[model samples]
Every structure is written in C-alpha cells, then in structure tokens.
Target chain A: MGKVKIKKKSTFIDMTAMSDVTVLLLTFFMLTSTFLQKEPTIVYTPSSVSEEKVPVSNLVTILISSADKGKVPEGKDATEAEGKIFISFSGGMDSTQVAPVIRGKMLDEALKVYNAQAKDSKKIALTDAQKKVFQETNMLGTSFEYLPELLSKSLTEIDKEQGDMYNPNTGIPIDGNKDKNGHLNDFQIWCRAIYTVSKELHDNMATDMGLTVDEAKTLGDLYNAITKDGTGIAIKADKDTPFTTVETVFDNLQTMSLNKFSLMTALTSEEEAAPAKH
Target chain B: MAEVQEHDSGKKKKGAQKKMTIRVDFTPMVDMNMLLITFFMLCTTMIKSQTLQLTLPTNEKVQKEQQNQAKKSEALTLILDTEYTDNNLPKTDEATGKTVHNVYWFAGLPDTTFQTNLLAKESFMGDTKENGVKVQQGIRKILREQNKDVMTNYDELKAQWKNREISKETFDSLAKKNAADSTLTRPVVIIKPGPNTTYEALINALDEMQINQIARYSIQLPTHTDTLLLENYQQRTGETVIRPTVRKSVVY
Candidate 1:
C-alpha cells in the first residue's frame, strides 16, 4: 500500500473581513446609542397602543418602586417596599437652564416651599456642601427631613441606603397631606418646586433667550413642557403595581393642580379582532 | 488582502535591493472593536419607552350644576380588577403568559335594582379570527358596539391612510375630529378601577377606549353602588370576586 503525503498548510485565518464588519457595527452603535439612565429601582412599565414618544428633554420622571418579589428579609412584608417614589429631572440640552442649574434651583425652591409650611422645629436647612451634593444627584427620593443627612453621605453609601427599601427614610413621603395652600407632603413639595421653577425659567426666556412666549412655546421649552402640553411630567411605574399605589401619586398631582401628565409604557401593536366561536 | 507585498523583477541586477512583504495582523483591531461593541450594547437602551398621555380632571370638586351628565342610553362603565396568586403575585394566564385582568362592565347608570344584566364579567381576551374575518371579543366587543358610528368613520379613515389616499397627519387630525364628532352617537365611558386592579388592567381599559374611538371617558373610584353590583354578580355566578386587598398601599 502506497501512503500519500498531505501537504502542510499554515493554520492562520484572515481577520481583515471580520475587522471590517466589527468596525462598521461599532460605528453604528456609537452613533445610535443613548446611555441608560441610572435608576435606583427597576420597573417594567406597562405596554400600550399609544404611539406618542417620550420627550427627550425638559422632563420630570416620577419612578414608583414595585413590590419586592425577589429576596425578602425574614419577617418583612414584600409590599412594604412598594410605592417608593423617586424624582429625576432632565433639562433641555441646548438651553441655558441645564439639568444641574435646574436641579439647584429646584432644591432652593423646594426648601422654600417646605419651610414655608413646616414648623420652626421641622424646618430643613442644608449646608452649602449638601446643596452642592443635591445638585449632582440624578434621582432623589428622600424626604426633606432626611435630605441633609442623605446628601452628606458618600456616593456609594447614598446608593446603598436608597436601594434599601425597608429604610423608612428612603422614599419621598406621599402620605395624605393634601391641602395645597397648607401643609404639603414631600412629594407635593417637589411637584410645586418643579412647577414654580419651570414657570420662572419660562418667563425669563423672553429676556434671557430673546424669545417671545409664543416662540418659547414653539420651542417646547421646560415652561411649555410642564404647563401647556403636559408631556413634561412622566409617571414610570411597574405594570404589576396596585392601582391604589398609583392613585396616591395621581391624587397628589391632582391636589397640586398638575392634572395633565403622561404614563410611561412600552409599545404594543393593536390586537386583531376576535373570531366568533361556533 | 491584509499584506503589503513587494514584487521583485525576475532579472537580477547588480546592487538590487531585496523585496520584503509587510503583513498586518488585524486580530487585535478586531478584538478591540468587539470589546467596544459589547460595551455599547450593554450601556445603551435601544427601545425608547413610549408614553400614554393622560389628563385627569382637577381634584377640586366641581359644582353639581356645572357637571355635564351623559345620556343614560349612551353610558358604559368598566370596573377593573386583577387576579392574584396565593403568594400575592399577579396571576398569569397559562395559555398566553399574560397577567389575568378581570373587568366588570355595566351600561348606563348602575342598575342598583338588578333588573337587568347589571354587571357582566369579562377578561381582556383581545381578539380572534374566524373564516378570515376579524371580530371583537370580551369588553372590547361591547365598547365597540356602543361607539359604532365613531369606529365606522375611524376604520374608513384608516383604510384611506393604508391606501395612501391621505397623509398620516391628515388622517390623524381627521380621525381625532371624527372621534369627537358631537353628531355621532357615541358612548360616554366611565372607568372605575377597583382597589385590587393592577395598573396594567387600567391601561388596557384606556387602550380599549382609544381603540373603540370613544371620545368622552372619565376615570373614577368605584362607588358603593358599584360594589353592590359586583357582589350581586359574584353571588349569581358563584365566582369569588371581592377579595381583601392583596397589596396594602403605604398611604396613611
């Protein structure tokens, strides 16, 4: 039997085509990517047939925590963690009033409203450093009483405490403090602050940006966003959350006269009509 | 393709330089690009969330005289509730893997006397096809039946848009105008979500309103009469309806 010799070949594979493909994909991703906003708790918003897209800027996101269906500490109710509200503000990118500036103004405005209604002993006074920290916070959930302490902590500690749903001091208190002119809850105070601050910025746009009210309205600035069109405020909540929990937020908004708002939802196609059963 | 090759002349000359081939290995470039793509994929949100615009009437009490009353013949009410498991998690439909949303609807002012089929029960069955024809099922069927005029016009407008006879903006404005047309016989829907109703169920109800092209609808808390109707329906059907609140809210 004659043995045939196999020719030896190099074990190298060409990566030029692979490199070209990856580069093209990387370019596409770099151009189309929008970084996911860091939220303390995750929520799966309900799906709807509504086609309106959430505005990119000049928006206030009210995030409500869902029940802890995951791990729960012994002897603790999972529902206790539900309904914690966090507020995040996004200002227009090109506007003079960016996120940090608007946030700083919101802190001042919230404190003013809270102090106006709070008793002398209950009043909150934040240090300059704490105020600076508050300005950098993307999503804030603590009540006014805990705001100073929460802002004093390091970033890691702040995140840890905020994620701890059992912590009584974590969420913005949404108890039944409904009188608009009188004592308002921390959630109400935040809403009032947002409204007042946006109005102030909208009025100043005439002189500051050299735009008329009509022009600013066309631009869909923060002022027109919250007041006129109602697309500015978005309520993001877990789909499985109880109606009563969402109703609490709605009731508070209604009491504050922010009757118009949008609910965040995933897109779903309309279901076809059902067939008749024989 | 990745290598730069220098070809040498066959004829040898004195003082001729040697031809060298330069090869470029693209493995590292591919690796770096893959790492970048992974990073971008993980950090980015490709599907932007949509928004359903909602406008609630102000909480301030409206004067009774100023309140507009719907004609009794053109009123429909939907009460929403969600099923839960023993562990207090929302119960899902085994077939579709979707949360089971229970909806109870009644026509006109709640028939406290129970003289008619006061509160009929329905789930969000969506739709089904029979003989290649689409038909509405569940609560959607009832709502669509009530708002037939508006839906007829809406379907025509939709067909026009689909056939490229009208632009999307024109179709949208025309459909909106048709939905709000006062001359059309439209049903005024009152959505009353029970305490146990999930937010998804409420959204489903709102979506039905949009789908049916119903112009006037308002969300209200379930009244005592509504509770009575639910209790009566439960007694007649022998289905356990009003359970204690599964998840107590944090509200004081």
Candidate 2:
C-alpha cells in the first residue's frame, strides 16, 4: 500500500463562489442602509415598548435639552437650567462641517418655493431678500429680528456650545409668548415653514397625479398628517427636564393650532413598571 | 498570485505548443469581500428610533356647552408630581438614581374646604420583580382596574381572532373601536403633570395610559375642582406635591 500511494495533489481550492456571495451582500447593505443622524446633543430618551418608527419624510423635529448634565457656574443659581432648543427637518442635508450654511440654504430654497406659490393665501409671507437672512443658517436659536446676524455671523463661535446644546442662548426663542396680533413666534414660524413646504410638496405630488387642491388635503394635510403619521412634531426633551418646560413648548405649539405631535423614546426590554406608591 | 501550468495532452499537433491553464487563487478577493461586509454591517443602523403618538386637544376657548358637560361616574383624575425629600424639593430614587415620581390620584373630588382626610398618594416605583411574577403594587393597579373593561374586550377580540372566528383586520378595528367608545363604562383618565414632574414621569404616565388601553384619556391642566382637592390634600398629608402655577391666562 505504501509503495502504491506515491502521488501528491496541490491544496489549492477556488474561493470565487464565496467572494461572489460576500460581495453581493456588501452591495445590498450599502444600497439599503440608512445612516443615523448626528444629533447636536446626545440624549437618552425615556424607555418604552412603543415600536412605531419615526417617519422618514415631512418631519419637523424640535430638539430640546434642559439641565443637560450641565455644570453650574460658581455662585450662579443651580436650579435655573441654561436649556436650549432647535428645529431640525427630516430632509437634513448633514454636511456637519457646514451645517448652518447648508441648512440655511435649504431653508432659503424651501421658503422661495413656498412664498412664490402663496400669492393668494391670507397667512403672512416671507421674502427671499428679507432684512434678516434666515436662509444661510445653522441650528437657529434666534428671533426674526436677529436672524440676519444669526445667518451671517461666523458659525465657529456659535457652534462652540452646539456640543452642549444646553447653552441657554442658542435655543430658538420659544418663551410661550404670542405676538399681540396672534402670530407664532420665530420657533413656530420655522415649524410653519417646514409644514408649508411639506404642503407644497404634497400638492405638487397630487397635481402630478391629476388631483385637485381639495383632494390634496385628504392625501397630506401637513398639519394633521404630521400629527397622524410619523410623529408630525417630535418633542425630544432631556429625561430630567422639568415638565413646565415641556408644557411651555406644548403651549407654544397649541398657540400655532398645531395640537398634534409625538414624543421620541428609547426602546427598552424591561417589562412595564410603574411608580410603586400604591 | 496566479500561475500558468502546462497541460501535457497525450495528442499533440505539429508545431503546436502545449496548452497552458491559468489558475487564479481568489483567497485575497474573498478576504477583501469579507472585510467590506464587516465594515458595512458595523456602519449600518438597522433599527430606527420609535415614536409614540400624542394628540393635544385644541387650546381654543371652552364653550358654555362644553363646560356644561356632566362628569361621568368613572372619571378618574391622576395628578403627576415629584416627591420631595427633607429640603421640600424633588428627590431621586436611591436605587435607580432617577427622580422619585409620585401620583396624587382620586376617583373624584377630595374634601377641599375645611377638609381633614389625607389625600391619597402613591409613588411610581415599578422596579420590583419577584420570582418572575410582577407585583402590581401602585396606582397602576387602580388604573388597570379602571381600564379593565377595554382589556376584557381586547382579550375577547384576541381570543376570537385566534379561534379564526374573526379576521385579523376586523379584530383589530373592533378592538380599538370598543376601547375608544366613550359611551362604554370604561374609566376616563385625566392626566395633569405638575410643574415639578419630570418629562420621563409624564412619558411614563402616558405609557401607563397606553398600557391600560384607555381611550377616553386627555392631558389637561388641573381643573378648579382638582385644584381645590390638591390644596386640601397638601395641607392634610404634608406630601411634597409641587403646586404648579396654574397659568390663569391659558385655558385647557
């Protein structure tokens, strides 16, 4: 037997098939994957079993951070949190390096489209060349009057506290105040702008399908649709933030007649538990 | 690396060189593909964040007709506020390190004018798990009981669907319809989060509402009667319930 078994064979095996499968898988993931949006301030939303997905379109995100584990300056009142907030959209063109500029441009373009079509509407309209340039913007935390400075001012200094969005000054002024003539403040204005653009898109899409404006309302009335589908308005607040602040935010929304919204929460596996005071 | 091999066929033609075979090893290609797959897997976010739907009723001025709407027998009001420690301020739980949230709940109005009874108070500490059997010892138990009607209906629908007596769509639609019907005997929960209540507490309370499957629920500022009850409860029990400044200017 030893004399007969003298032949040696090469150990090479073709791996072409394995490589083909792996390459296919890689391409599938690359094409289908959606990247997580980079939040200016990281937050741990309260846990719940609600598995409803945040809508990927026509979303207006109101990011709020109050008492964001901030350091109290010596001798400053510790109770008064330097909280802040900002408005973000689902169509966030995340060029983080030039966030404000790109966001501002997007807002600018959206408004131009919105205003051009609002010739007969009763609502107050904005112009492309408004004295305050809100088009070249970052996460806007300013008023309508101060928007020009907010847009043009170099973003380097403004973006410093962006990491700590709890920087009190950076939040859009949403003090739960309504103008004497009954108008949404700067914060609500931004929300309305997003909604207006969404409505325009909805109308455009409907018209393309040979539908009328009245028919468009049933399809996508940005106000109620936002509230109904994909949490129309998501108020992401810090867990420890006082309810008054949340209430104030809600109060502002109510003033705009935007009565429907959703709250963002983390998914937790823990079984439903309640506060133990029976 | 690929190497050429001379295949010496038994039959050869005149002036024809031996046929050569080129075998290319794909091990390096497979390794690169594997690396790419791993990178894509790590970079991709497969799970999207979840959203909990909430609808705030219009903040329009209340009409006389609405004010005249009589209160039902099963109307339950839950006052969410923070529990304070020695400093008369909100306290965090020692175990979870989260703020200790409490509920001042009642089936109806508490004795407010010259009242002496202690207003019922319970903390929402659902952290206890005993032998895999959860001990329901909190205001949740009462809320669950109040919402039993819907649960019973839901169970019936689920059982019917399981037995194939009803289609899944019919079962779902009927179940939600039954739960949301205000004319039914189910309890109506009114949630009022006090100023001191944390956002987590409000969310938890809302979660409780969802868990209970209660349909006739609303988030409102404490009404005048509720305010009176709270004042009496605070004076009598000495529980640190933050008296949220009722914005007299705004109406729920």
Candidate 3:
C-alpha cells in the first residue's frame, strides 16, 4: 500500500469584537450614572399634616439648638434625681430659642462675605489720588465685630432661666409674662440681626464698589429677585431638636418678610423609632 | 540551433518562476470597532436601582378624630403629640366615668366638651347602667347628623340604580358624589394622645372611625423641622425637652 498523510485545520476566534461591546457598555453607564452629593446629617423633624409642597428655588437655611439645662425649667431637680430636663415653655420653648440663632447665623454668613470682599480690594493698594477717593468712601473701615458681640448677648439671654420675680403673684409661672416675652425677645434679636447684617453688607459694598448703599442693597434685592416668586426662608434643624424650636425659627422667618418660606427635613432610609419616654 | 534552443528554454524557465503573498490592514477595522462601541455606549441607558423615600405619618388618625370637635366646624388642623411612658398603662378616659368598652370607638370619637361631659356622667354612674348606652346614643346622634345629606343622596341614587334607568357612568358619579359630600360634613378627628396612649387605645379609635364610616382622615405629627430643632436643643443644652401633656383645641 502507498503511504498517505492527512492535513488538520486549526480553529480560532477573535475576542476583540466582544471586548469592544463590553467597553462601550461600561462607558455608557459611567457617563449616565448619577452620583448624589452627601447630604447634611439630620437629627429631628417637626411633624405636620400640611400637604403643601415647598419649591426648591427660594431657600434660606436656618440652624436651631435648644438652651442648656439651666435654661429649661425643672432642669436642676430633674437632672439631680431623674436625669430629666423640662422646657419652661412646654411645646413652644424650642421655637423661641431658634429664632435668635437664625438671625445670628445669617449675620455671620453676611459678615464673612463682607470680610472676603474687603480683603480682596486691599490687595491692590490705591494710588495717592485713589486713596483720597477710597478715604472719602470709607468702605474699607466697616467692622463685623459688633455682630458677634450682639449674637453672643442674644444667645446668653435666650439661655437665661425664668426668674422668680417674673412669676405671677399666685406663685405659679405666668404664661404671658416674662417667659412669653422672652420668647419674642429671641425673635426680635433675629430681626435686628438681619437688619444689621443687610445694612452692613450694603454699606460696605457701596463704599468698595463706589456704588450707593442702595445700589449695594441690590445684592439682596437681586437674590430676592431670583428667589422671590417662591418661598423665601429655608430652615434645616437637627433631628434631635424639639419641634418648638423649629416652629419658632419658622415664625421668625415669616415675620422677616411676607415672602413665603420652607422648612427642609432630611429623609432617612431607616425609620426613627419613637423616643423612649420616662 | 542548440544555442538558440537552450536560450529559449532558459527564458521559458525564467518566465515560469514567480513569488506570491497575501496581506490585510487591521488599523481601520480596530478604529471602526471602537467607534461602534462608543456610539452604542453613549445611546444605552443604564439601569438604576433606587430606594423609594417615604414619610410615614406618626399621628394616629382615629385618635385625632376623637379629640377635637372644632376641627369639623372649620378647617381641621391636626396636631399629634406622642409620648412613650414606661408603665404602658392605658390612659383613662377622663370624659367617660366607665372604663372604655371598645378601644376603636374611644379613639375615633371627637375629643369635645360634649364627649367629655358625657364621659364624666358615665364615670359618675359607676357601673350603675348596663353597657355604655348614653355614650352610644351621643355617637349615634353625631353620626346621623353628619351623614344626613349623604344618606339622602345615597338613597336617591340607589333608587335610581334599582330603576335601571341611569347609565353606568351616572351611577358611579352619583355614588362618588354622595361619598364626597358626606365626607366633608364629618369632622376630621385628631387624637393627640401622649405616647403612653396604648396601641390598644389607638387601634380602638381606628375601629370606631371605620365603624362610623369616616373615610377622610390623617394622622398628625410634629414637622420634620421641629424634630430636628428638638434634637439640636438636647445636644447643645444636655437637657431633656419637656413637651406639654395637655390636649386642647385652638380655634384658628
């Protein structure tokens, strides 16, 4: 028999097509995926049955906190024995304390903006002739020190306890006398702070930018112009804070301007188990 | 002759000799594949799994219904104040002298001066009467008044329905119309029981509202902002915030 040989065929596949498709899918997802920014930690929220949906356009955030133990009623007794703290104003105490705090925080933010502007203008010293113009303007001389002191005093007053003298002749704490007035005092301080901050910022901007305070006021006016159609103030209180405090903040904000405002609440995945009562 | 033949043979041999080779360019193919992948990737929508955010009402709807009568007369405002007491002892119905027979009914009734006065009388009776006849009578009276219009409308529609003269759409509309009109007259009951108010108490109120056929109801609670402020106050002062234990109605 004659000798014979058989040839074998080799099989191969190109993976480049599959790799290209996978890469395309990966790129698409990467581009389209939304990454949410980490939101602030929220400790509490006041409850309401209002179904009114607040718009996101106009918002001024207010932070609120309660007074210390000495400020609340029955604090000394409750603390010593049962480790309990009782607010003097019942459901409304927290609100009273927060009104002033918002005012203070707003002032602080305004002052920070003013200081930043002042420092930037100072970097390029004015010419001898320009210095006279600047001196006449006195824009650089504005001070924010007054704001901090005022805020501190307001905070102190809010933290003060109701006095025996303020108690009614019947020896029971009067509902409308010192305690009620005290609550309003915080609100007044907030209003005053807004006035002060807005005034200061407007004046300084006018002097620095060589515009009138009225022109400087345009900054707030512009902000209002943009956010005016919707609710004005946006308050975000810690979750653990009392509902009274947040209410007070809202009340103060409402009084500041007729413009509508909203309260922001942080939503969480885990349900808040009701607080354990004594 | 031999030279010419040899030369011709050499030329023929030279002409027969040749070299063959095959080649393919891969650059354009790679580029095209990449471009196709990019286009597909750009057009495709990525699947996203998201957690639905929800705000659950903390106030008990039935309880709110039992507390204030003014809510029915005007725009109802429900304020829920929940307190957790260690004892878990059910709250005494300060209005009724007798112990609550049905938790649902107790929770659903409006917390009004009338209800309170009735309860006070029942409590005074001190088991002198069998069952809560007076309380049942008071509830029935209010329910009848609230539902009078709707009940009448329902009867008219039902009669029309029996006649087989009305279209399906008209019948449905009539039924819905009757339901909505009746619902409006009925006050939204708000229960602002302290946390110590037992689950049994809350459930009883719910049952009562359901039995009374009160459909439009909402459980109220402090706003999110209020809760946050409370937390902040506690942290800053290291003090416990004491909320009011009283349940009162304000006419706004």
Which candidate's DockQ is highest? Answer: 1
TM-score, model 3 to reference:
0.31
- Cα distance off (Å), candidate 3, residue B210: 19
Interface RMSD, prediction 2: 6.3
Point out the worst 10-residue segment of candidate 2 chain A by lDDT.
A92-101
In TM-score terms, which candidate is top? 1
Question: In candidate 2, what are the lDDT values of residues A52-105, reduced to their tens digit?
Answer: 787765466787765534565666543344346677755423232133433454
> Which 10 consecutive positions of candidate 1 chain A have the poorest summed lDDT?
A269-278
lDDT of 1 at B39: 99
lDDT score of residue B244 within candidate 2: 40
User: Using lDDT as the measure, what is the rank order of every candidate, best first?
Assistant: 1, 2, 3
lDDT of every model, 2 decimals = 0.87, 0.64, 0.34
Chain A TM-score for predicted structure 1: 0.92
Which of the numbered candidates is closest to the native, going by highest lDDT? 1
Q: In what order do the candidates fall by DockQ, top score first?
A: 1, 2, 3
Q: B1-252, model 1: which lDDT tens digit per residue?
A: 888978666367785766867778899999999999999999998988999888988878789998989889888889998999999998887766788888898887877789984888887767677898777889988988899999998999999999999999999999999999999899999999998888888888888888888879999999999999999999889999999988896555
Better by lDDT, candidate 2 or 1: 1
